[model samples]
Target chain A: MKLWTLTEGNKEFINETGSITKFANRFFIVGMKPRYEFKELLTQCYLIGYKSLPLVALTGFIMGLVLTMQLRPSLIVYGVESQLPEMVGISIVREVGPVITALIFAGKIGSSIGAELGSMKVTEQIDAMEVSGINPFKFLVATRIISTTLMLPILTVLADAIALFGSYIGVNINSVTSFSLFFTQVFQGLDLNDLLPAVIKTFFFGFAVGVVGCYKGFNSNKGTKGVGIAANSAVVLSSVLIFIIDLLAVQIADLMGLNY
Target chain B: MGNYAENNMRLGIFVLVGLIVLIFAFYMVGKNKSIFGGNFELKARFSNSNGLMKGSNVLYSGIQAGTVKSLKLINDTTIEATLLIDNEVKSFIRKNAIVTIGTEGLMGNKVIQITPFKGNSPLVKEGDLLESKKVASIDEMLQTLSRTNDNIAGISDGLRQTVVEINKSTLWKLLGDKAAANGIESTINQMHQASINANAFSKDLEMILSETKSGKGTAGLLLTDTAFATQLRMALVGIKSAGDHANELTLQLNQMASDLKKDLDNSNGFLNFLVKDSLMIKKLNATMDNIEKGTDGFNQNMEALKHNFLFRGYFKKLEKEKEKRKTIDQSLRIDK
Candidate 1:
């Protein structure tokens, strides 16, 4: 199939989209039928999810704190200053917590995954693996994808908790609300549907970031410069895909009546 | 191998913490009645639930005691809401408890308020159907408000028409006249003076009223002094009695005057008979002389009889009685 576009950029975009789609299909075909890379998957999970925790936590905490402080005056003007906890809680859990954490993860881990794999290809380590009867894609790409998919939700959960704790401190900067009371207000009238959909969506976020990063890395060219380009493009594309996937998720959640 | 195990352990802990936090969040967000405790079911039927959904708090006498279990439409107008109450506080909710849908905050969720009956009411059993009442929802209030808004619009329209009429009327011309304006100004000045005087008068009146309330003067005595009132009552009674006597005396005088007038009108006046008729005059003179002689003879005989022996004791006793009467009269005069 050919995409007829006047610009080479458009043509390249379509070409990349097709290749990524095929690559994602191949991943499903190959990764699931693996001589299960459990050890590699664990190490990747440790590197991707655990190592990403500090940055995600920092981003989430700042987002929550700043959001509360900004919303404080407006909420006070509306005479609902007490609703700071609840509004911040919902924004973090439902939208901000997962999405922002994913963006940060894409920046840190996407680039890292891309550069690492690209460098391996450039050095012919992947070729060496293939010649030595070892499946490089199975060991590297599959493990990374599975790790990111499994670990991102965990990371998002931790970030959400941290952000809420930050918001608690933010709330205390102006008024005194007990920890229990703050939590009670946050949880009051909240539904499982809200939490489940948000958590479930992060899986797709994780998958998009992983696949884009791996796809960029696998298709890299021109040696060392290729790795840098791969890393940069991986971050950009995966970040875009996070927002896109978020839009699709909102629509799907609305369709399923899981949006509260 | 040791480094690998340590890293794995750290990763395991992090993942465990994340999973724990996620579960905690879900639990906090969705926990209702019977989640961590035994719960008893209670039901209430309302005409309109008015957005009171399931999992709404069932606040028993303003305490969190339960949660709304489910809502079912029995008919077009009736909604049956089942409640799941914690077993710990189940005994407090009486069978006669009243259920009403209330709002949490001004712009917050709807809640079910259960008011406990403060009498010798029995404890609510499992699946008891409690009483319920429908409260006005925000939508209904807004609907009423819109109707009121229409009424206000109509009132303003009428006012505007009245104002326009006034603007076009001859009264507006009259108001612009110099003489009328001067007259109005004079009247207003006089009214201001009158109001000032009235204010002073009112102050005096208020002071007088306060004084009267404190029993200060005759009017105050009449109002507040019971003894003074009793004395006035007695005085009025005496005056009434005196007036009655005076009336009787005046009536007697009137009767006597009328009798004398009748006698004079009959031409039988003694002075007229004596002065106008000569024969009557001669007879009256002879009769008078005879009466004088008889009176003198009688006096002489009484004097002789008083000196006789049998009459002497009686005369002496009469004299003694006179003396005693005189002494008694003297004593009465002294007492007076």
Candidate 2:
């Protein structure tokens, strides 16, 4: 689809919208057969999990550091400087943890998924799979969906942890705080309302990444140039989807009376 | 393969450690939320809840003893809030304790505060109702402030009118005028003059008194000599006798006037002749008729005189004669 794909008439809307649902349904069908897709899932896990660790850590650490530095002075004005760790920790866990991790996932996992699939398309591997009677869609789409579904919440948890550590280090730059006290503050500031909604939204984020990456890669054309287009478009689309999904999640959570 | 395996092992350990730390932090936070711990329930009700909700802090002496577990509307006018508190802190809360709603920071969440009641013997029973203090709402404070502002406005209006009256009143202007100042100054000068005159009069009276003490004037002779006193007393008695005679003559004149008034009322008074004497009346009437004819003749002559210079000169001569006649009467009185 072009950038203005949604601006077209109902026929185009149906074609574009219909394909997403169609792919999601097929991915689910393939995902049910766990034994067949184990190796694929393992490989995806390694690529998404271990490979993405350093980037997520770096982003998470910086997120914690910057947030603490920005929030410290304001808390100090309120004579609440002691609660800085708790405040920063709550913010990171509830909001920054999921969003930053998902954005980074979109940038890293999304582009890689698009490039890999786009290259396979350009090389005629999809055609070869079709000729050999293997379901190429199932093989490619299921592994990504499973891996992303399992990975994003885990990544968010990891991100929230790393961000708090960074905040602790940041706090110690100007003031001393015990690790126990720091964690206490972090936990004390958080409740179910802060934690559950953030964790829940990451599933949508993972789904967006999986579906958009697979769609862009699976639909590649124009030989060598199409691979680059697919990779770039996948990152952009998934990033947009992450923000949109976050907005809807917040609205729904607000309606449900979840205070964050 | 050996080096690669070692690197993978270290990475796995690192990921495992990171996961453990993350879980530990989550558990700590969850425990603070009363998720992992066995907690007892406490409830505080306030008349003005002020936007307090579930999970708002329940504070005892500025320490967070628990969290608000839930809020339920009891009726149209009241809300029941259930709290989940750590079992350790529940003993300190008594049955007679009062709960009031207060704010955390200026812009922070509303918290339920329990104040210990020292006087009451009955302890707070579990699920028992505690008396709630009606924490004044911001609206109530604003209403009082508006009344104060209106009173201030009214006072300022009254003060402004008073000032305007002072500016415009004629009496106020009169007291302030430069001419009035001069009037006061002149009055003060006259008073000074009067005071000086009184002092001089007093000094003169004192001098006269001194002279009398020395027996130097007629007053002194009268005061100093006993014979002079007797003679003066005799002279005063003779003067009183003469005054009595004069008074008797005045009484006689009064009696005559009384008689005349009675006669007039009876038409037999000499004054009644003026009113009833026929010959006198005829003469007076003839004189009045003659005077009328003469006045008419005089008026005709005066009108002619206005046109005739000779007649005007004759009237001027007559006016000179009248003046001469009055002069003659004056001379005659002097000659007599």
Candidate 3:
């Protein structure tokens, strides 16, 4: 009876692999898809970018404000009070900006993708599409994956900019600095060494968020509990992957002597 | 449809703007390294480059002129560095300029400074080599300071030893020891002796002067009588002159003696008998013995005469003269 159950599990694994391959093959099928599906990309961008803006902005602002408040005393100990803006600007642009923005994106967009897709799977919408010979993976998973993949980096860049502005506001709360000079000091402290590695790492962060969210939601099982598992695991896995990818990127960049 | 297209356009614009800003920032930082601007190259060679790396700031007259573009080991000994100078200030660097590695500040980055010479030669070309001066290292300075301190310590030690030696020397002991006590004792003894000797000598001198004042002994009379002293002085002056004249005559006498000896040795002149006189020698000895007996008889009579009453009376007269001197001294005494 255990041998019979093992055979059933193996058969299910082989069937899943076979369908995943079919989905990949259907991705390039040109004639079946509508040109108006491009509208869906825009809608995804709006939903991802515009809908998530408030939370991203709020997180960015709080991150900037709190980081400045925390780091200010340490920098002051070094007698570099005038360099606070420049230091904060460099940290925000190079490290904090990308990382905090990516984590926020992971929290907002990752769960959104997971829940939306997981709910669809549970409601038999995915099965209906499959029964009609429509590839649900290509339609739903690909769109959400592609949307997160593209949207996250853009959102991160916007979030980084807003965060720096929020840091400027936080700086002015206790310190006085002009807008142009603050940015100049910020940009002066920034080098290609700091900027390139940080920006490059954000792409991997976005990709991880998309892939992990899509993978979890698509492979989700059970009933309503499966959707909960999908959403929870998507966020947890994406956050973990974000840190993992960042660590690896830092190591590789350090090995290349691109970042110090 | 329009809304969707417009949203896409906005996204595209956002992406473009982000890329542009990132690129611009990179360009600004790169331009600080003179990567974006036009620059000229100047080469300089140094015997010891002192580990000056590429991208070290090059300064001229305390102002930033360029950066060290490359450093290469020329041989077993020397290093050659290429400086990327700002094109606008190329004319300011003359051929005779000296380049040396210096630091930005005590805790700052390494930099190369160009020390300009007095009169300008031709401007340094792209590959021209410049002279290098050695920068004193902190370790070397510390070593020199330690050596100086060591030298000072040695001198102080030598001085201390010299002072110790001086303190231990006989001269210092003589100055500082029981010499004062010895001196005091000896001075007291000498003072007592001198007082006794002085009293005795004064009594003797007083007796002699009294005797001489009444015309007694020869030396006493010569010392006490004023006329005798004057006559003795005149006689001495005359005798000195006579002695000088006699010495001059003796020189002539010596010449005469030498002439007589020459004549006697020849035995052919008037002195021939003197050279041959064997019988005359016996006659001369008898005459000399007779003269000696007469002198001995005269000496005996003189001694007897000195012990006679008149001689004793003369001594008694000298004692009376002393008595008279004592009376005169008493009469002349104002305190009495």
- Per-residue lDDT tens digits for candidate 1, residues B20-130, read 999888777656434556888999999988788777788888877888889999999899999998888886888888999998879777889998766788898999999
Worst lDDT window (10 residues) for model 3 chain B? Answer: B28-37
DockQ of 1: 0.54
Q: How would you encode candidate 2's per-residue C-alpha lDDT over B1-336 as one tens digit per residue?
A: 675555556546655765686577567656766666766776766554689887788887787777878888877788888878776677787877788888876656788887887875565555666677888877899999999999999999999999899889997899899999899999999999999999999999999999999997998997898999999899999999999999999999999989988888898966889977899899989999999999999999778876697667777887899999999999999999
Models sorted by DockQ, best on top: 1, 3, 2
Judging by DockQ, tell me the better candidate of 1 and 3.
Answer: 1
Off by over 4 Å in 1: A1-8, B32-37, B139-336
C-alpha lDDT of candidate 2 relative to the true structure: 0.82
Better of 1 and 2 by DockQ: 1
Best by lDDT: 1
DockQ of the two-chain complex in candidate 2: 0.21
Distance (Å) between predicted and true CA of A85, model 1? Answer: 0.7
* Residue clash pairs of candidate 3: none
In order of TM-score, best first, we have: 1, 2, 3
- Report every candidate's CA lDDT: 0.89, 0.82, 0.77
Give candidate 1's TM-score. Answer: 0.70
